[model samples]
Target: MAENSSSTPPGTPPEDSRPRPQYGELAPEGWSWTPTPDERTLATPDAPVSSAAPVAAPHPRGTAPRWDRPVTLSLLVLGLLSTLFAVSMLAMITDSIQLIYTQLDLGGYEPDPSVPGLVTAGIVSVCLVWLATAAGAILLLARGRRAFYVPLIGAVLFVVVFIAFSSAVLATDPTLLNDPNLMDVYGSL
Candidate 1:
């Protein structure tokens, strides 16, 4: 071979013309790269290792999550209860009116003493119930429950209808006065 300008160092044969080994690489005879015990353990592939523990089972889908807000549930319950109470009162008034009409034979008769008071009381009760329902609905909506709004509005409208019906009944029959016999019953007051 042509004289290799890349000569070996002194006290070494020219056969060592290859590149010197790095600190981490295998060395010449009588020397070798040996990994530490920890390095050897890591390098030995025993089994696949996971960095984190397994997670618990996930919750089922499509069910409503548990509610944390007490006010929301309270408002919903209040709205429902108030609605039921108003409906019950209205139904009672209706039944009473029907009974009066049927028993007194006054289905199409002129306005009389007993009937006017029932109509007036029904109207007042309906108005009061409507106010209560409206208040409950407002609370429910403010607490993020939107389902109660329609029923609440319906209750208010029903109250208005009752008021109108009462007014018409009173206006059509002048005998539907607050005191037809005022001079007899409460003339002192």
Candidate 2:
């Protein structure tokens, strides 16, 4: 029979340079080539046991995985941008409210026929609510568990508000479309 040259010397592994078993493959006395549990039963009683340490079962990915850098950074950046946009919307609404109050005080300005005062108030209230929700979403992202979804929901709300606000402004002030700056940009394009 061919000699079992593969068998390691029966003692501590050689002090000379050699690869050490990383997982639970080496026992105190000698090397253990015991078949994995799925493949076969334990080695015969006379056969040298490979390892006294129990074989470690493979772990499922993501059970304790670290957050990937790119994904986490992307989500964080999105959340921050969403929050900033919501704040800007709130500021615009507040500024418009102030302008309306000033015009009413002067008794020389009138609300647009196409955009009623009630609709403007409603738009302002909606913007405030969006800002609050976006702030909450940004704060919740620190938990890192299903937090990215909050910002996504805020983004949808932002889109709805943006469309409604734009339509109202365009309906009330079609002349704004003729601004020299806008014409210049379009002409350049």
Candidate 3:
């Protein structure tokens, strides 16, 4: 028996097959490798695709493809810097709890309170969202996507997330509402 060119080998699937998405990954499960209608065609019958063909780029090249313009590179650098800052804040979250307790002590509050998981959850969630935002923007930047609005959208998302988490933190903690001193500190924050 003879095999047609269209027949995949018995032992292995073709390289063009779609992959299963990971848990929490942005790609939807069951997504196929087939190119979407919105995407540009990779190759033409007249010309085969080469390694450089992808980066050779079209005009404006959508967002900030590095080879096409300096803006993407600039955004990459800024995103990295902001990532570092956000990571530092995440690193310092534990210390902030100690500081919060100390302030409560200075205000003549009695015994030390064990840290609240709600507050911790809120803080960590906010930081993780921030990191995720930066990471998403960076990923888009690397992929040569038209991603100028990704970071902008991420910033807005951060504020909204912060507000939601902050409200939860406040609402759950009665001490913040009962004591004027704690309220002042929370308000300052």
Candidate 4:
């Protein structure tokens, strides 16, 4: 059997006779068919689509794409720097603790029974906690997750620790504030 060129398949019209939408016309309600680039090219008689058209790789569900932009790069860098800084602060804290003990043992220096040891312990504990927080932030960035919130939390913790320690020191001995060296550091006695 031979098919007639003039006869179209049921529900389909000849290509040239199909209605063309005007520039600002609204599409029909309930079903709007927007052709993809490949489909458009295939439909055009003169423009045959090549078999080598590029296909985008499908992403795995539940995971967001890792951005290669400057903002993400800078965030990773900041996380690394924060981790390094925390490590350095931890080292400094250890040194401060050692120096305090050394002075008491070798320099014949006597601090108040409970205050100096308590202050030293507090400083060491705060540094260790901050170090852990910074490490966690770095890990989150490495895993392609948002990480700056961790460091922000650490900063707020630092503020609280500073205020607590400063108040404690002042309560123990307000005379330290009267010293000219400390006054220069603090801007007021």
Candidate 5:
């Protein structure tokens, strides 16, 4: 058997890093021990130990968080403005429909009868802008996610859809494309 390297001088006991037995009682050879954990948790026969990670901690709540306060205020303004913008676009679509039908009587110009589809498309575009602005505002305030691009995207979509519809309408009559009245009303000539 290998000799105990920590063997003390003759007639003295060997030293051990672990705690000694009570009352100087002897421990068996090769004895080992593990200390209790720093945290003590009670377990019952029905409880199973789980090694899964703990759920995420919730964010702190307050009446008005610093970032949320300004965002909410800005969202309210944006919501109102977006609604007005949508209404204006709707008015424009109605005006165009009226103009096309009335122009049909102007010296046999015969404006295309397919204006309802264009009107529907225009309305959808306007609604998309309003809906997007509302949804973005709500989501930003609720989740604190970045949604500043929502307004820009909605505006661009409305513009693109309107331009396409307008060009298609005017294309049916090239003479109307150069009409001063259209230029004055659309201001996009």
Candidate 6:
């Protein structure tokens, strides 16, 4: 009925005969292993440890700015400016039309029916270009779509082409280009 007093379990070598751990002596009963500050604390002994915190996954960079931010505000302002340009272009077309109509009423000049058709076509084309540009701006501002660049470039090219065409057409018909009466009407608007 007596309790055993031996340090080693039955069949194991005696405590004095076993090799000692290199770093520390055998701990007393109920002693548990714990890591030092220099050593990483691990959820479990078998878990991997590092001197520093686990590497946080890198976040993506160069994301588009939010709507409430400065970039978005700039785009909105540009869009408003574009809208104003479009409106001014429309007003110019209207003034041009009114000038032609007034000239026809006075019988001082006869209208070339072809002029109206060509002017109408030009205005329509310009309007289409402006619309496409506005759409591209919206897409760029809202969704950060790089595809908007294509339409934006096209719109710019269209504007250049329109100016060149208008200049050429006006140059060929000096009366249409130099009419002081028409210039006055458009200038008034």
Highest lDDT among the candidates is held by which one?
A: 5
Per-candidate TM-score against the hidden true structure: 0.26, 0.34, 0.40, 0.40, 0.44, 0.40
lDDT of 5: 0.59
Q: What is the C-alpha RMSD of each candidate to the true structure, in Å?
A: 16.3, 12.7, 22.0, 10.5, 11.8, 11.6
lDDT of 2 by residue, 107-131 (tens): 2334466455535554565566556
Full candidate order by lDDT, most accurate first = 5, 3, 4, 6, 1, 2
Local accuracy of candidate 6 as per-residue lDDT tens digits, 1-189: 434557447876444645755445677767667677655644337856679978865434534434323544454455456645654554365355456656645333443545556556666666666566656666665554334354446556666756754554344444565556775655764
Model 3 over residues 1-189: C-alpha lDDT tens digits? 444556776767445545644453756677645546654354334566576636554656445544433554455456556645654554454465446767777443232233355445656765676567667766876666766566566667666765664555445445535666876666664
Tens-digit per-residue lDDT, 1-189, candidate 4:
455666877777546544676543656667567789998988778855669977666656533354523344464456456545544553354354445445434333333466556566556656665676668766766666666567667667765765565456445543342335544444663
Q: Which pairs clash in the backbone of model 3?
A: 63-146
Give the Cα-based TM-score of candidate 5 against the true structure: 0.44
- lDDT values, one for every candidate: 0.54, 0.53, 0.56, 0.56, 0.59, 0.55
How well does candidate 6 match the true structure in TM-score terms? 0.40
The weakest ten consecutive residues by lDDT in model 2 span 61-70
Worst 10 residues of 1 by lDDT: 62-71
For this target, which candidate reaches the highest TM-score against the unseen true structure?
A: 5
| Deviation in Å, model 4, residue 32 alpha carbon | 28
How many angstroms is residue 119 displaced in model 6 relative to the true structure, after the best TM-score fit?
2.3
- Give the lDDT of residue 55 in candidate 5: 60
Report residue 12 deviation for candidate 1 (angstroms): 32
What ranges in model 3 sit over 4 Å off? 1-115, 178-189
